[model samples]
Target: MVMGFREFCDYEWFSFTMENYVVHILFSKSEPGPLLEGKSKYVELGGVYSAQLHQAHTSVGQTHIHVYARNNQLFAMNHDGSAHDRSHGSQIPNKVAQAITQKFPNFTLPKDNYIESAPSGIVNAFGHQLLLG
Candidate 1:
């Protein structure tokens, strides 16, 4: 089903183990629709975000990593944990990487490892097209 950003976040937060990795994928621009106040942010193309899973919370948690889109490029800002370096490059711990890879082979390490622009549709790394609605 096509999901709104909040619905997507809820699914990721509650449906997985704490050990599973999560990346908050943001598009460059907001899709045309009504966005819930304070819950969703409009994104630009090339905006990137990464976060290390801390204490698992089904409803709430700390926000980490904020990369702004500049000239269609993402530049990392100050982040909360060591998983990301100043370069905005990912430093995903080995164990977390392995678990994610095992479950989603299309999953790429270092959220920015690929050079392609983000796809407009919801598809995982394995090219599995997700029906967002």
Candidate 2:
């Protein structure tokens, strides 16, 4: 099955992100609040996103989309927070970096550290310990 689609986020934040296509993976030490107009992509993985990259359709000060690879494959995280265990690679990021390079020859997608920092099976149940740890 070839998924020739675009746009996705972590399961916990999947539904919310759908409400607004703009993925705002936060890096600041802040909580998701009214200020976070988009899908509230938290700082689970400290990465840098250029405000110029995020596409249109949004009402916020900053904007950028989040893309990650699990087990060397790129798939949008579900809304149920089920995609927890896997290796995060730079597959999609490589593409984005290439696209940006066309215009800004000095662009590199910031490697997401969630898969690097968090242990296996920890990405899904982050902070939601009450669910099942």
Candidate 3:
């Protein structure tokens, strides 16, 4: 079922923040209906393992529309930076921290050179970096 922008945001906010789920937002500058060829596109993409369809909306006075999907894969990456072949060692790197903050304005990393220490198996998901210690 398709949902509106407000509903989508509400669901996303609740799921990501309150429920600790990952949400992937796909935005389009055009109507998503035609582009998606109706709901069947979801199945064609990757079945249930793929990102779940959340909503598609066009701006009130504009032609742009956006599609939102959710999944948990974003946090599945190994925190050792092994996925990228670089060991961050206890603290998040300055450059990496900066990029995270830039992508998510609401997020703030410690101003100090490094964070105290993160817990094991921390993952960066849903545009938010999870530093569990």
Overall lDDT per candidate, in order of appearance: 0.33, 0.33, 0.31
Q: How much does candidate 2 score in TM-score?
A: 0.21
**Candidate 1 lDDT over residue span 1-133, tens digit each:** 2333544533422232234555454432324333333353433222232222222122332233333333222332221222322443334445444544553344344443321222312224434443232
Q: On a 0 to 1 TM-score scale, where does candidate 3 land against the true structure? A: 0.21
lDDT of 2: 0.33
- The number of the candidate with the highest TM-score is 1
Tell me the spans in candidate 1 whose CA falls farther than 4 Å from its real position: 1-30, 36-87, 110-133
Estimate the overall C-alpha local distance difference test score of candidate 3.
0.31
Looking at model 1, report the run of 10 residues with the lowest lDDT sum.
114-123
**Residue-by-residue lDDT tens digits, candidate 3, 55-109:** 3233432111111123322211122222211223335435544544444344334
Better of 2 and 3 by lDDT: 2
Q: Which segments of candidate 2 are over 4 A away from where they belong?
A: 1-64, 68-87, 93-95, 102-107, 110-133
- After superposing candidate 3, which stretches have Cα over 4 Å from the reference? 1-89, 117-133
RMSD of each: 17.7, 15.4, 15.8
- The better candidate by lDDT, 1 or 3, is 1
Worst 10 residues of 3 by lDDT: 60-69
Candidate 2 C-alpha lDDT tens digits along 24-79:
43332233343333544332221342322232222322223343433222322211
